[model samples]
Target: MTDHALQSPPSAPVRFPPGLIFACLALLGVLFLPLPETLPVAGQRMLAILAFAVVVWVTEAVSYEASAIMITALMAVLMGTAPTLADPAQTYGSSAGLSMALAGFASPALALVVGALFIAAAMTHTGLDKRIALVTLTKVGASTRRVLLGAMLVIVLLSLVVPSATARSACVVPIMMGVIAAFGVPLRSNIAAGLMIIVAQGTSVWNVGIQTAAAQNLLTVGFMDKMLGERVSWIDWLIAGAPWAVIMSLVLVALVLKLLPPESDNVPGGMDGVTRSLAALGPMTAAQKRLGGVSLVLLLAWATEGRLHPFDTTTTTYAGLVTLLLPRFGVMTWKDVQARIPWGTVIVFGVGISLGSALLSTHAGQWLGAQVVEHTGLDTLGTLGVFAILSAFLIVIHLGFASATALTSALLPILIAVLQTLPGDFSRVGMSMMLGFAVSFGFILPINAPQNMVCLGTETFTPRQFARVGLWVSAIGYVLLLVFASTYWSWLGWM
Candidate 1:
């Protein structure tokens, strides 16, 4: 064949570059929009940059890693040339602008994120997380329904140990798939489908419960530290959020069982399959034992921080990570985990912090939050009313994006500013904590959560089946949030 004929056909061109075009339009629109008398040029510029970030993020114009770097560059130039709030006559300068762009890297919450990633890597490298899931499954029962409950229990334990929703789900999916195959069931069978959906949805449920469980949680903690001059300690976070997660866990199980009843009540040898799988491992390795001990101690330290001990979650996590890297005490070397961690998560996280800080420092977040409060009439509402409204906003807005981390980065600082501007009686930290829990409500679609996508990959379940359960989970979870706000949370004085 001729060279032209032999060559593969070129990929079809996209209809248009919507993401990049819209991002540019948004940037220009905000920059040129009517400037309120109280808003500075610098604040306006910051707002423009924020708009650009939000559009690109929602549209996914590029990788989040690339977008983070691009946003930083935009801040450096736009902010460097913009007049300072103190003196409109002088510019803020590129050096200060660069520092502002990179400020989030310095946050202790980011350090906690780094350390949590390392812990997840160590667990995967040593296979401890999977083993834990199998062992938990063996105990929860053999019937397809109880097996689903067992999956939820496994999600809870792993949420603590894995400290990553995606990683925790990754550890469970394979074991669950193996169980389905062992029973000789079709991949698309109700039992297989329900179990897979539970693994994905259950992970999202527990992400709300634990502070260290997801990157988005750490983002909220970072914002609290920066804006409120305080933080929700790990234990306090659990105290405030764990009830909703617990109730939702049961609700998820019940909804899945009701919506997708298994063809048979029992998996026959399903429990045996799990037991055999656990037995195949024979015994926990020396690495597993040491890692488990370190994890337990770290968990205790996290729970006791601010109550029994002076060290914070970040500090204690660093201690465990250090032991894991030590020569004799270490479970794995750098070579073992260097390739395992998603370092891009670290980059985006730190940059997200910087963006929020910049928005506040330049008064951009304040201006935007003021406008939102004014338009939404949030100040007219009582404490619970405001919570219900904002919680609904979070869940609704959450539908447009996949990464809750990106959504938090884009909106939370503004949310913080709104809470601050509200002329109502509410604890800043407490309200922030409640709102932060709502940010983990990524239950509507398969694309909303990494774990959901991972579970959806097995072809055992369809997106329709997932959303069928997600709709109920979200509804129940929202109602539970209101109830908790009125009673349990208020009793704790969290409202």
Candidate 2:
């Protein structure tokens, strides 16, 4: 089958049965009854309804923002917060709830994603991604193991420039596909293992090193700011999370090397073919240079945000302005940059944030916290352990969730409440759980993450193949979280 045939359509034009959607939402209303009597009826009902809407929406491509709007409207009306159509419309517009929903759009992290997309588009336009792939493959010179290692390194380096995992995967997948075809590598064989491992590992590695590397990191920061009135600094995040990322990446690479050693001495279509294909693509264009320069300025702003005044600009505001002005400045056309922004993602983040704020403001998270604490029957270490395990389990389960922003927004507040009840050091435990939830267990399925979906498109690895490695990797990652929290966190005085 051709690529189009193999791929699923992006959206379904036919509306799903309203009865089904309402039935699910109504069932959720029932589930909220036992949540805790301490939760206000309005708050409990809102949570149940939002959660139900999000679940249904995930199974469709109904444009996340539209779904968010529907949820906001439904809540405003059903809860009698508005009491009339005009009231609900006005309430929706004036809502602190809506402002929180739009928070992700105003985040520095989203700017980075937008910047990265333009950069990736420019690189693709300039044939840079293809050129890099060819050069790296040639240097490896028929050594299968070295090629796999090179691919992982290339991806790791690319992460600094390509902020979105999906974009990075898209940029690399075609190159890998061509390489496999050229080499006559069996799609189901060891080579597939190496390709899958590198993509999965690379995605996870970047998720750790920077705030803008993944949407989840930004969501965590946003939610934390709303709940705790504090945000993690980039340097602090790198210091705390990078070591684990490095260790995990290395472990994944080593496992791939051992499990899929190169079997052939043949160069696969030879270096000449690869060079010719790359050469056909030509050098960087003017648009690429402009995009690169704009992106660099944005990165510098983020890195020195706290230290430098920069005319008293906030990083997100700076980026948004630049993104808005770049086209007028003739750096890149608005068409180019606008298409690059993941608006659906922004909406998902906003809606999640709105719901999370409601949960906190109404004391729903606190109510849930009391129930969990009472039932777990644990204190101190037991409580911390319970939180860690719960965080780990949630991370794994969230693999099925498409929106990282939505998942984090909905769950982090509850997790934070659970952590707040812990003894000794609260921030240390909270931060550790946050990191674990942000990075671990996303490799289990393609739908688990954007990068995973990107890798899946290669047709080199099946879902079963991914699960084989993912199961072990996830288990190891959780254990590492426990170890890192118990030892390193105390050493850093974060706990």
Candidate 3:
């Protein structure tokens, strides 16, 4: 992927908006005033805090970092003060209770998110991402259409090594600029829009094919391991998900070409320029060598960790990260890595873990799952019907979330809780894995995924264009996923 310069336009100065302040105050008053008879005190407090956080996230009432911090603070304070049905014998503020509310900060998955960020930063810092893109494009040849397909393939391949879509998108954008310059394509031309959208969608779609490809996939895997005691190996995930990813990538190539319709159909010197750039890179730098070496070590560790059972995913991932930051052998300095890591994402993941734990600890997940099952009678629909219902819900639910990690952190536990009510043959792990794939299905808006945000930063595609054309791509991908989940997954003994 090409490392594109992706500085977003600056927003207006921050001033506390009156409406948001009023809404926050009103929300606090309503939530803290009294407990509903049907809701447990702990659950109520958790719900109130989550509700506030979601509103803040959705409305941008505050910065994301501020919202995440506020959520943690609110959860710790509120849950510490409330009593819960889970432990009628003890108060909510007990060490055990506080652990339930504040465990997000200590979550292994949270550590993994931080580690992944460092790995991505290391790749960017070392210019390894650009080297990969130039080398791939050189062999991909000169046809513009072929270059587009080649670019998509490169993005998919990057998922195997570059776990972060943001990292890959950042890398790919600068490369796309080279292509634009080669073709003399205007910045706002349809060709530019098409290319940018392909990078955005391609990175997101391929993430599902590999278990280690996305943070949210790991989060879901971790949740399922804890909730159902079922561990999905890399091979198992690839078998079930790789087809969906490949099919989606092919569809995306078609969708972007049809919807965006690039103004130029050919690039006369695209391959020559790519080859020249690759030649200029000459040999891999020491930083690139070190980053590449550690990346492989981490990949191998993650792939074998389930069978070997040596260390948790967090530990395995961080081990590679720590090696990258080692003083002499490392690729990047701690200060540089720290400045580059997206702490906001880490904060969100931590708070999300805490929130999910609080929900389970208070039996909120079980209660909500029961209510959903009672109202929908989904379990009575038989295995296939239940699968269809849940899959549809998961696919469409992406509209509400911007961060796939945050979405997975919050939803997987509830989905697992819901599955516990179904028949034994339903395969909770399979269903949860299917939903995990759908977490990457947030294609309809710029705010839906980090890759989408990266595309928006390019100022090429409008939100409305994304929502309109993206709806078709998302719908096609959903139907294809459903077909596979019902057929191939069942054939493989996963359904």
Candidate 4:
């Protein structure tokens, strides 16, 4: 094999540059400015400093984990909050930090993601996902237009099964590659551009379909809990969000098809040929059957989370436990499932949740919220407008950062704070709109989202092409959000 073929994939570094370190310190200093007269206790002040460090660290404005350690050290030395290294070490594992670290493990959403990973793994090992993709392509055939539509439909469906955009891209990209080669389609064809948009849109559109679809959805739920005392139930979330999700997804699909019309010759013959191709794929594997069974049950659980009466967590928790116990049932093994979970995602999610907790505990989020209210005024419509525009801008700015978890963690809290100051009815509408749009608009560049980077590697859509579609999509998406917030949400009685 060639050296390049034998080489391992490159891994991200753990250290920060001198400039980043200085910038982080500068931000930390600003966070401490006009330091509270009482200092919020040495321990609390230390935590405040640590929280700011984490905000930068998780955002990739600095290094991950490095900031956590720095905060520990600072607490031990400057704050004198701990008598010795051992005492500070205990603080490192405090309920606050540990709670954040445990966030991933504790989240039913994350557990659902873990379950989906196992499903993907089992499908791949059993040749089920590949078979499905092949069937899809052959059915769509050489028709560029049909292939584009089929690919989009397939991806949108897959979004239900695959929580992570990057994972969904990995599953679909190979199929596109095969189709491109078989049909003699140019890599830069309009079909390819359509596929790219489909992938990006698929990443977030379904988040509104179900509570477990995206981590950000759960974050919104948690924020609502803080603001309203009870988390938005799964059924409530679906009712409030599904209509918008469906409408926006259709709009996106139409926009992609219109903007990048597929080649005439590449269109599929008819539905009959597509059906026949799909039928050609043999029986589903045991793994696929088992995973699908569990997934269906999970879906039912999510759909009826509140109405069922016994307890909502019961259904979700049961689904997770069943997934973890599948090996004993002869469905899949612990080792098999363990290898599938995205450990990096778990870490990032944990860090994001931790930083969010810290922000709340330290009053940093409130401080930021206060600054915004002071500058923008807190009128209902004005607050909604500001959050919509600011969130759109931040989505682009996130390209410079690494962690979506961190960005959402910090911003959601502050956004929620601002929403609280609005009329009660407007608060729910405005906050939901901002959070939903923020997750959807991470399409300006590859670095804005891991999924975008995955598609970029397919050698299909160029960065320029992705950006062109993204710019238009982002504009339309935000406008739809504003309209929905101002109109549909109120119409549906969500407000």
Candidate 5:
């Protein structure tokens, strides 16, 4: 997402926010709920801290960066003071807890997220992203249908390079807005609404396909690495995710077009506006050429992971970032990109990992997983049944929280625990990967995702308008996931 500070669109109206309600209940739970015999002192305290983080994050009662710092401090004092199971005689030192809180910063997954931000900054700095977007958009005529398709193409192209969905949407929204102006239609017109919704929805579609596309995906990787002792490589993720993303991309365009048919069949001069935007960019500069080459190399490195090269995605991304920041060879300077880096995101992401790590290391995840298995009887279900229930659960829970990162941080550990404690012989890694994909289903609300909010800020569509399309997308997308799980994914041995 773009600097989240800028992406704050108006939210869904309510007498009370979900976070406030959850926070009150969470407080009650902490004060009254007895610790289970199977759960540790540390585990119980960790749950309290998790609840606190969830309330703060979901409510936006505080900035996410601030909440991360608060979580870190909470972990240090709370977990630090809890008695160790090994020898209730000893306590985890506060300093040691502090280190645990900051552990996510050291993760290779965090490194990749930072690298992606730098790459995104570079694309913006060198004008490569806008140039590329306009270049693709200009290719399709200004006809309303093709304009929608062109928007999707720009979304796909940028999702590959920009990595952050909010940032990708930020880049494309203005360009689409320009197209709407060129068409000589009101920004409130159906064509304008469809294009904006497509841009918003398309970013989400690709987030599922690419591993580096969203920070939450990286958080999933960090958990897999720390909890599962293995990680899904880049190529494998794409192979499993791309076909689904490709089909959904088509679905997104078709549904938006259907629900919000354009004001006119052919937007005469629509192509002209996109063309003028491209022409105003003039010829691509040398910096753009350099950035483009580096991004392509970085993308190739990503696609070839565990295949043509032994290097992990994080390493290759940093190598490319280094090229962009080098003295003479680099496309950008620290001064040029520093402000756009969204340091708050780094803080939130790091602490989120630390939070989840604390959960697993404390065996809090295991205890919770055991309870879920025992109570839900997920143990009795077949693999497909498990996926359906979990996927549906994720979609439902997603409604309460706005940030996918926060949702993943709070629930993924539990979900992972759920999978771990479930009895039977199913692919744990595969289920984790698919479940991670489910976390991206932030459809059904404008505020459900930051990217959606970015487009919402354009005022091209109302939240109700966006939600209408989102309802269809989420329902159909859910069904499509099941179909893929039963057939294509099974054929690929992913399930």
Candidate 6:
């Protein structure tokens, strides 16, 4: 491989994007718009800030962390109608401002994400991720088709523990590159394209099946529990979402294989190279075994939290992290954990939660919900019709949002508000799951998700190829999920 090919995609130099200027002007327009006096002052301010934040996030005018920080500052200043000197009992928005701007930092959901990151770090430090990938890959033997299945299986299993799609991709991609190299597959060959696409898509596809598979999934659960008072357990999410997750994962494998077949059907030396790589790693280390045990126990605790009612998910995750950091029983050090976990992700979630809470507090969801339903004529549709239409709309909406968490955090409140207007008993949990999972299905572009970007970075596949194949995959996935939502979820009393 060329030196340049091995390096990450080059970063562009700092320059002002025209989109940022437009976003600023748009925010000013919203702030100064002359409207009737019926709208709550707090709601208007919250809505304007939400619109501003959305534009800034979608346009990539600034880093996500910077946007989040700016959001915190704006919430405190713009949303507050009273002076700081005012007493709490006398002030209208002072307490609201403080709570809305800083509530996310105190959220248990944020704590869960932090703890989950430590678990991921332990997996990396102990090389458990590599061992799992190798063992799964070697079991499938040397046939190209089998190897592809093996790769998909590894990503699915890894999702149960790794939680982050990008982290799972990071672990699986290196193993795939080793397999491709061992077989002497050309860097630009069809085999390389198939392998790379599956690794990226597989990790994303399975993210919905497991509750802890992605940070956004956890955030959705938290939103439901905290905002709606509908606690969606891990087992509940798995029961409702796993069917589609499995189906879509297999669909991706078949789609990529048909779209980009390997150069040859079989590896020259069969599973020999893959097996040799696994053998080279020697037996599982004591640390790997220990981490595995801790992960398994943690997974069980989350899965049973709904029925057993033990410590909450966040508490369980933190307890596990503490176990991992113990001097003798633990597998990782605090310093190593700090280096491995992305602290910025915690910041993003904290700010996002704070903002979502502000919207709910100011009744922004109810106001915007009424407007969307009225403007879009959603109230006129039948139950299943609403599902299909909204499902399609949500799937396409992914084009405008950059991060899955941002997309969910921005739109979910509105969705909840809209559902409340419906005549029948609608499942907030059901709709929330649909919206959260749909954002991750941003197949039209590489910027949709980190895993897609990781795959594109390999340079074996182009955006054109991904779009051509992804367009149909995304369409089919949307339809398939809607069908299940209408038929299966309805029978189960979820709709």
**Per-residue lDDT tens digits of candidate 2, residues 163-249?**
666667777777776666666768866776577668765676667666666667766766666667667765566677777777777
Sort by TM-score, top down from the best:
1, 5, 6, 3, 2, 4
lDDT of each: 0.90, 0.62, 0.76, 0.59, 0.86, 0.81
Judging by lDDT, tell me the better candidate of 1 and 3.
1
Q: TM-score of every model?
A: 0.97, 0.81, 0.89, 0.80, 0.94, 0.93
Where in model 3 is the C-alpha error above 4 Å?
Answer: 1-39, 86-90, 94-98, 307-312
Better of 1 and 4 by TM-score: 1
Q: Candidate 2, which segments miss by more than 4 Å at Cα?
A: 1-28, 31-37, 57-66, 79-141, 265-274, 293-300, 308-330, 382-387, 428-433, 436-440
lDDT per residue for candidate 1 within 1-495, as digits (tens), equals: 799999999998867558978998999999999999978898998889889988998887888999899899999999999999998899999988988999999988889888999999999999999899988887877778778888899999999899888888888999999889877899999989999998898888898999999999999988998998988999999998998899899999999889999898776676777788899998899999999999999999999998899999999999999999999879989999989889999999999999999999988899889999999899999989998999899999888778989999989999999999999677888888888888888888998878989999999999999999999999889999999999999999888
- Across 244-345, the per-residue lDDT of candidate 5 in tens digits comes to 999998998899888898768975576888888888988989899999999899889988888899999889999998899999888889999999999998
Candidate 3: lDDT of 207? 80
Greater-TM-score candidate between 1 and 5: 1
**Which prediction has more favorable TM-score, 1 or 6?**
1
Runs of candidate 5 exceeding 4 Å displacement: 1-28
Candidate 6 versus the native: TM-score?
0.93
Output the number of the lDDT-best candidate.
1
